[model samples]
Target chain A: LAKTTQPISMDSYEGQEVNITCSHNNIATNDYITWYQQFPSQGPRFIIQGYKTKVTNEVASLFIPADRKSSTLSLPRVSLSDTAVYYCLVGGSGNTPLVFGKGTRLSVIA
Target chain B: DAGVTQSPTHLIKTRGQHVTLRCSPISGHKSVSWYQQVLGQGPQFIFQYYEKEERGRGNFPDRFSARQFPNYSSELNVNALLLGDSALYLCASSLVGGDSNQPQHFGDGTRLSIL
Candidate 1:
């Protein structure tokens, strides 16, 4: 399983963009990076995923460099509700279990 | 459509007792996975079952076991529970198995407290 490292916590003001980066130096060639957001008492919700370059969705954007060693999750115009923990996962396309690190606790203040 | 659903949102147990948590996958989903999340920590993988068969197991001890039914639902059973076993038990389901790239839907989870 590929291990990921991210910030322990971050604080952002409301209406500002938040970018959380994760490092996976040992990521495999077939591995993909995925991001999820978790609110209190709720399961982690999928935010975005990308294999390389950039992938954007209605919720967020994922930017993966060509080296695939790292990726960043960008949330535009964050609100107080966006205050939650964000996890970045790196894994192959197999049945391997997901490995979640401590994750970055994002606090969006109004 | 309804997302993944878990039974008994909250459970309280005592040491040496046993407990079983249930999960129902989303419509058309065939894979269900179990995870344990302790306070201030991310979830730890427990088991992954696909098509009613075990596909993956985590480092948890034998006291932690799980099984899937023909309908793609799953149950996680733990015996000889210790106080350290207290945590939020989560269940996730994906449309297919053996693919980590695919997004898996998760349930709110069952809060189990060992007394």
Candidate 2:
């Protein structure tokens, strides 16, 4: 399992762009970077995933540098509802279960 | 289409008691995994089953066990529960293949509180 390190918490205001970075220095070659968002009393929701470079979707974008040691999740134009805990997971290949670290809690202000 | 479903939304058990949590995966999904989420921490993987076979096990103890049915449903049994066993037990289901690429759909989870 590849361990991930992220901020403990972050604060943002409405209409602002929020960028959360995760560091996985020992990430494996076959590992893919994935992000999940969990709201209060709910399961974690998939945000974005990428193997390398940049991957964009309707919700957010994942930017992975060439080294693949770190990745950033960019949420454009945040809102109050965007407040949640974001988790960065490194590996899920084959039969491997996802090991989640202490996620970064994003508190969106009105 | 219905997503993953877990039974006994909330449960309370004694320290020496045993408990069983059930999970029903989404239709057409063949992989089911269990996780334990303690307060103020991210969820930790406990077990993963594919096609009714035990595929992987996490760093949990022997007291924590799980099995998958032919229908792809699963049951997590914890024996001799303790206060530390109290947490949100989550179950996630996904299609078996490129596990990294396939996203797992999660249930609301069973909130277990041990006295």
Candidate 3:
């Protein structure tokens, strides 16, 4: 299992692109990077996942460097509704239990 | 198709009491995992069941136990609940249990309050 470090909180204006970076210096070769978003009273939802390079989805984009030690999650044109806690996780396999950090609390202001 | 569903959206329990939380995975999902999220913190894994078998267990105590049914639904049982047990219990289901590419879909979760 690999641990992740991210900012505790961030403030962004609506319509701006917000990029949150996570550091996993000890990431394993087989580990995959995944990002999840959680609202105030709901379970975390999967945002995007990637192994290397960049992967874009309808919700967000994940950028992983060649070293795979860190990744960034980018939310485009963030809106007030995009306010939530974003978590970055590294795991070897699906059956491997997910380990979550405090996460980055993103506050989108209009 | 419906997403993962948890029963009794909210629950209240007293200290030393037992509580059973139910989770119904997505239609074709065969793997169900349980997590506990406390206030101001992220979710902690409790257990994962695949094909009615236990696949993994977290650092939680013995008081936290879970089992999956034949239909892939699961029940998380907690014995001798304490005030610290008050948190949001989440259930996530994935298409397969061993594939990292398959993301887990989560439910809104059941809020358990221990008083």
Candidate 4:
């Protein structure tokens, strides 16, 4: 399992873009980076995933550099409803379990 | 289409008591996993079952156990429950082929409160 580090919290105003970055220095050759969002009283929902470079979806975008040691999750035009805990995970390979860090608390304030 | 489903949305138990939480994976999915989430913290993986066999388990104690049925539905059973065991028990499922890269879809979870 690749250990990941991320901020504890971040605050953003509604309609502003927010980006949360995660660092995984020991990322492996077949490792994939993924992000999940969790609201109060709900399960974590898949947001975006990527191996390298960049991957975008209707919800968010994931950007990875050549080093593969760090990745960022970008949410555009944030809203109050987007206030949630965002988790960046380094996918487990070869029967390894997916480990989660403390995660970034993204508060999309009005 | 129906999403992942967990039974007994909420439950309460006492010490030394045993409890079982049920989950129905999304149709056609084959892998199921269980996780425990305490307040103000990210979820902790408990166990993952593929093809009715245990694939992976976290650092959790032996009191935490789970099994996947032939239909891919799963049950998480906690024995001799402790107050600290009180938390949201989540169920997630993924396709076998997408085991590594595919995201696991989660159910709302069952809130277990131990007295």
Report RMSD (Å) for each prediction in the order shown: 1.4, 1.3, 1.2, 1.5
Error of 1 at A14 (Å): 0.3
lDDT of 3 by residue, A1-110 (tens): 89999999999999999999999999988888989999988989888889999999998999998999999999999999999999999982556678999999999998
lDDT of 3 at A92: 27
The parts of candidate 3 lying over 4 Å away from their true place are B97-100
Candidate 3 CA-lDDT value: 0.92
- DockQ, ranked from best to worst: 3, 2, 1, 4
Candidate 3 clash pair list: none
Worst 10 residues of 1 chain B by lDDT: B95-104
Q: Comparing 1 and 4 by DockQ, which wins?
A: 1
Q: After aligning candidate 4 to the native by TM-score, how far in Å is the CA of B109 from where it should be?
A: 0.8
> Candidate 2: lDDT of B3?
88
- The Cα local distance difference test for each model comes to 0.90, 0.92, 0.92, 0.88
Cα-based lDDT at residue B80, candidate 1: 100
Clashing pairs in 2: none
User: Ranking under lDDT, best-scoring first?
Assistant: 3, 2, 1, 4
Minimal lDDT window, size 10, model 4 chain B: B94-103
lDDT of 2: 0.92
Off by over 4 Å in 4: A93-96, B98-100
Q: Native-contact recovery for every candidate?
A: 0.56, 0.54, 0.64, 0.51
Clashing pairs in 1: none
